[model samples]
Target chain A: MRKSIAIDMDNVIVDIETNWINWYEKEFGVKIEREELLGKPEDEAFPDPAAALSLIYKTGFFRHAPIIEGAQEALLKLQEHYDIFIVSAAMEFPNSLPEKYDWLNEHFPFISWKNIVFCGDKRIIDTDYLIDDHLKNLDFCKGTPILFTASHNVNVTKHKRVNNWNEALALLGLH
Target chain B: MRKSIAIDMDNVIVDIETNWINWYEKEFGVKIEREELLGKPEDEAFPDPAAALSLIYKTGFFRHAPIIEGAQEALLKLQEHYDIFIVSAAMEFPNSLPEKYDWLNEHFPFISWKNIVFCGDKRIIDTDYLIDDHLKNLDFCKGTPILFTASHNVNVTKHKRVNNWNEALALLGLH
Candidate 1:
């Protein structure tokens, strides 16, 4: 049995637009400045892309996206074999870890206030299996590495990748 | 079965004191001038702690930390179920990720090339779990957090913590 399982919430479990809206509003005051979204340049996407990227995990944008399709089922099932945890890098600190934990608790019984780790580095959160959407994370991860795919990952053409939960399960032989 | 794992080298899996000594002489001007190891000030680990940190990761100081007891065994067993990755935060450039990978490969097969993530925040590495001596990193994780014990961590007194492979396994119920 897998001892532990970790799931990424955004993109893998939640949509992207949720965070984009929040970032736009908070960083650039773009909610009142809606025209900024219609970019002559992508500056409004992240008012300061470089700084935003560095602080992305600490941003208010996390916890905003809706869980991806089938992520709930996969996470719930994975919980049966592994101690489950949500390893995420959010620039935003929720009012409390319990707030996010409670939100997740509504869906999955195995996930709880104790298992949740909210930090800038998802790697520090220990688990046997960490499902993530970002490729760079896989660079040093040991185990069955699963990549949640997206349009931006197009350039990552090779190197054994996956787009969804079904593919990830099959790839890992969990299917 | 665990599918993903994250490991830390310096001060986590191995001791880097001597290695740092070698680096001090080579990169910086004089040894005692380096100061920190000689019991200098809090921030003066070197002429530039950032430079020292960068050189260590770059020049193999990180690759040479004598393996902590049970480190090899713990990592090997964890690898059976998880895709292990090295999510490290070094101040170095392109050398950060690859150098860490090399150190792992040279020292332990458990930490192979396929799984290694070199980054600064680590929270951004996007793993389900990350291991580090920094309680701050432990405090900042976004998942099922595991705080591995170190000499300095003894004073950290509270919060869920672990000392070695056995304790870590117990934390995840793998033991």
Candidate 2:
């Protein structure tokens, strides 16, 4: 049997930061630089933290998040070597589950519905490798935790890190 | 720390059989006896197997499933002694995710969103006890597999069985 890998959806596969930054600029009419927001959590990055954070709770947030660059190609390659599961901490946003499903269906068509997992907590997932952006999710993982880089998680350095899809591919020996 | 328990949604906490039976009767304009469904898979028990199976994939099927008798009370009591997680294999029906969430919210309000897991497979779930209706799910579980009785699973006697919520409570020593 092939080894299994549990991948986080939000920052790992879907680039929520870019969409959020764009949404924040459009909503508040204030252009924010990606560099200026580096190392800051989504809420703390903006002038109005509450308003910026509220975007995630909105209905279409996950649906509109752009696919991370090189993710589709890397995942397709990884699929042949390992069992891939898209695990998202989405139960917190009850309305986002369907949107996340539709988002995965539309963007990552190669990923089967059987490989998707939407839950409130990530502690229950048992796999060989867990590639996630959030430390909270990875901290509890029994598998090898690979930290996927995001602006908010830039300061986190204890785990093995992957700055991009290419790095993740190379790190996993897929390259 | 309290031992964790993973509970199935359909045929366990939610009485999907009664709703499905009622749906079949209303759709086909025929009175069907619940006794006739004993030891038979839902699809095989009805006149139109395909039609009966189609009811599950239809929208609102899971959303409207009636709560099992004594499930809420029993679950609440169990919650004090065990860490309860409602794990459902729902990814096959992508659109049903939000509906299932809403259904849990409506009926099992005590089950926090943090404890719900909607996934395609149960193999990845790590818990101390898995109380599920399907043998396929239980067979893969690493924990104590407690089979929750359903019409389709009536013949299966491979695991610890609980015919209803009351029996389940007693079996778990909550009664």
Highest TM-score scorer? 2
Candidate 1's docking class is incorrect
User: Per-prediction TM-score, please?
Assistant: 0.42, 0.97
DockQ of predictions, in order shown: 0.03, 0.89
User: Per-residue CA lDDT of candidate 1, range A72-174, in tens?
Assistant: 7876666666666666443133232333444455655556544544444443444566677666655445544566775445346545677787887676566
| lDDT for each residue of candidate 2 in A7-34, tens digit (9 for 90 to 100) | 9988899988899888888778888788
- The lDDT, on a scale of 0 to 1, for candidate 1 is 0.56
Q: Which stretches of candidate 2 lie over 4 Å from their true place?
A: none
Query: What's the count of clashing pairs in each model shown?
Result: 47, 0
How large is the interface RMSD of each prediction? 13.0, 0.9
DockQ of 1: 0.03
Candidate 2's residue-wise lDDT over B123-170, tens digit each? Answer: 999999999999889999979999999988899979999999899989
